[model samples]
Target: MTDPADRGAFIWYELITDDVAAARTFYRNVVGWEIAAEGQPLPTGGTYRMIARSDGGNAGGVLDMSAEMTAAGARPGWIGYVHHSDVDAAVKAVIDAGGAVHMPPMDMPGVGRMAMVADPQGATFYVMAPTPPEGDPDARSDVFDYAKAQHMRWNELWTTDPDAAVSLYRDLFGWTQEGAMPMGPMGDYKFIQHGGDGIGAIAKAQPGGEGSRWQYFAGVDDIDRACRAVTDSGGTLLGEPQQIPGGEYSAYAHDPSGATIGLVGPRKET
Candidate 1:
């Protein structure tokens, strides 16, 4: 069974990329992280590089997309896993809630049970009852520290139907809308809380294909400097760094392998 505290928690982040070396470099420079190759071979048949932070806890894993997998439709992007009490029950609930299963529940021996699913609106993610890593029963890669570079500080979701999406998540994960702000054109930006911890925000997507997905903000020391590093590392900013509602600064960008990522930090004064 997954740890009680981890239920509905974003326990892990995975970057499925076509170019592993390029991804390793881009994130290392941009998020101030280091990649250490995992010694064990994955049951799924790929090398997993562990993203290491300053404090030495892992941040995520990088899986090099094989040509066969890419041809089968694997794209360079981040997929976050929500820890669940039971993978089968989670899959059942997802199907009952009108979502579609991309992969049926499967046990990976060393990795525990996992199933991939897309929400009713089609945003995909994984629900897994993960087997804890060797020594640590509480296996968590995401460390929340907005000031520490290499940590994931914020999570955001832009969906086609905000109200419906919010309802679906509420039913499935027990997340609640803690508060909201009027974004004028963006409608209401709602803060999503799981078990009282405000973890992310959600907004209705603008009229375009880019909306219905999740994006993560990697904490950095300086937003401006991170933007420069993004471009230097073969990534480009979607926009200039702007102040978040609470005064922290952030900017969005596409990584070298085409994965969209964001940088967050306090504004540095001259």
Candidate 2:
């Protein structure tokens, strides 16, 4: 019975790759997007290549990783789904803050109530709540809807210790403190909000940083033409395109099977 406009993030992203036709020709010649293979079914099995959204919707799904799932190492990233109303109390507030319950709140019979966390710096993600989908999922009735891809607003956290991951997500999602920015060479970023709802930001990890991860901002209208279409589709830009603090305009890249992704744009009217 969940169809209040399909709630939020009907399906934001999945992308766990091995090849799938060169990751759908490298995100369709870099983010102008277009790869709707239509038949989704690969958590580790067979078909999966529905990353459509050049106004086609269904904005995510691309798997091709089974060498026994990357020899059980499972890295080829991309995982972000947060529209939780209560995926078992957000997996018990990510195991009461120490965060580690990698999958313990299942129930996808219809399509909702998921759970898979990590956060004490292992940094995985997934905590949704969108069910009741069987026959109106899409096709110009356009019911799956995420507004048109790139709808996660923001969600960043590159940490080694941004004040203990911003006090462990501000006491597990009560969130606050929306200030602080000096990402000059990645020194101080800390900008978390929730009740005020800018939806994300938190930084520090850089001295060999490759630990914490959960970065997705996506919006896009045109930030230097999507950072030159993520460097003409090869993708790998990490920095050198900034202007943060709300007027927006981000860059940070990856996706040619690297999978980090961030490309905001718009929102500069102050």
TM-score, cand. 2 vs. native: 0.29
> Residues 67-137, candidate 2, lDDT per residue (tens digit)?
77677778677787755557787678677777788668877666667887887777787867766456755
Model 1 vs. true fold: TM: 0.92
lDDT of 1 at 258: 91
Model 1, residue 227: distance off in Å is 0.7
lDDT of 2 at 246: 47
Model 2 global lDDT (CA atoms, 0 to 1): 0.65
Instruction: Judging by lDDT against the true structure, name the best candidate.
Output: 1
For all predicted structures, in order, the TM-scores are 0.92, 0.29
Q: After superposition, how far is residue 252 of candidate 1 from its true place, in Å?
A: 0.5
The lowest-lDDT stretch of 10 consecutive residues in candidate 2 is 139-148
Worst 10 residues of 1 by lDDT: 37-46
Q: Give the number of the best model, judged by TM-score.
A: 1
Model 1 Cα lDDT, one tens digit per residue, 86-106: 889888888898889998999
